[model samples]
Target: MENFTPSISVSSQVTHSLLARLLALAYVDQEVDLREVELIYGIALERGVSKETLESIMLRPHSVSTILPSTPHERVSHLYDLARLILADGIIKEEERAMLRRSVLLYEFTEENADGIVDFLLEQAQAGVAPAQVIQVVQESI
Candidate 1:
């Protein structure tokens, strides 16, 4: 897969929502791992989100609206990022998998494709594929 740079600009709501979801996933095991925090922080930084804003969301994820991105690329990008966060701690908890499945529906992927997409994303993340490459592969298949 070639390099992919998502050109879409998402609202602050979307970014916060994604971060909030990441936070939720990180705590699925009942403890927040350092790796998970680092991954989420890195993602936030890459998207130009402020540390203060991320800290605020960390303090209160409920304040962030669950706004999904409008475009397929943006949706897949967010999903891939979530997949990466799931694999950050080198463990795949049942709760984390459940969250990814729920996210597929929230992202508007058809039910028929949701399981396969989630499986593929997890496989790619486990194999250590870059998020951009994983997003590109999924987009091409779509």
Candidate 2:
């Protein structure tokens, strides 16, 4: 094992973590739609995550830790992505909403503000507001 080293990079790890959570959110409704899978795969690919790594995480999401980005902007951008994924299939189940609440907490938002944040993000996502624009709005408000 002297020469052995972990192949996954820090960036890849973050990608894995994010994809895992997205996958979990997609599965919350007991049905993983093709749209959801496509969205997740698209994100993984954009982040330069290998197909093998993506598949591994997809097969075992629980193995990956829930590690959000360090910066507040990155975290909120991720939250927006999660909200976007929740609306991908054109239906938002109560289960999805609950999962998003838990995700908001994981993203380091206060419990008191989780609902409002989630609602706002969901509304923005539904309105087709771009992620960058949302990030700008959030950062300005802070």
Candidate 3:
């Protein structure tokens, strides 16, 4: 059988869920940095999430249940971006780590491998690795 890849549609639910998870992570440290907010807003805007919806979700991200991406690539992509957000404010607090675990569970990533995945992403991000490379390595690892 020929390998087939179905394109993942960027729906408003996906965008909102992605941002909500990121926003929840951002708030984990108890200090939402402007840079982090900017990144989330930028992504939300690009993904066609309404400003109003983004604001609402941003205000109460904990209330939003993240809609996990269905594909491997989508999962890795979201995890990569979450890693970026973790490093955005120049701090990765313990609180953020806890939040990432919740996100991993929410995304249905293997519980045992969740820490390893976050650690990998943090190492790559700290080394200034390209996003594409990070995703590629993550995909390979998975």
Tell me which of candidates 2 and 3 scores higher on TM-score: 2
**Global lDDT of model 1:** 0.88
The 0-to-1 C-alpha lDDT of every candidate, in the order given, reads 0.88, 0.86, 0.77
Q: Which ranges in model 2 have alpha carbons more than 4 Å from their true place? A: none
Name the 10 consecutive residues with the lowest summed lDDT in model 3: 6-15
Candidate 1 residue 29 Cα shift, in angstroms, is 1.6
Q: Give a tens-digit lDDT track for model 2, residues 56-141.
A: 98888879997778888888988888998998998778999998998899889999999999999999989989888999999999
In model 2, which residue pairs have backbone atoms overlapping below 3 Å? Answer: none
- Give the per-residue lDDT of model 1 (tens digit) for 1-142: 9889664355877888899998988888899898999999999998889999899999998877788888899888899889999999888889899899999998998999889989988998999998788777767877
Alpha-carbon runs more than 4 Å astray in model 3: 1-10, 50-52, 59-63
How do the residues 19-127 of candidate 3 rate in per-residue lDDT, one tens digit apiece? 8888877777788799998878876776677789889886777776657777877777777778778878777788876777677767787889888877877777667
Indicate which candidate wins on lDDT: 1
TM-score of each: 0.89, 0.91, 0.78
Q: Itemize residue pairs with steric clashes in candidate 3.
A: none
Cα distance off (Å), candidate 1, residue 41: 0.7
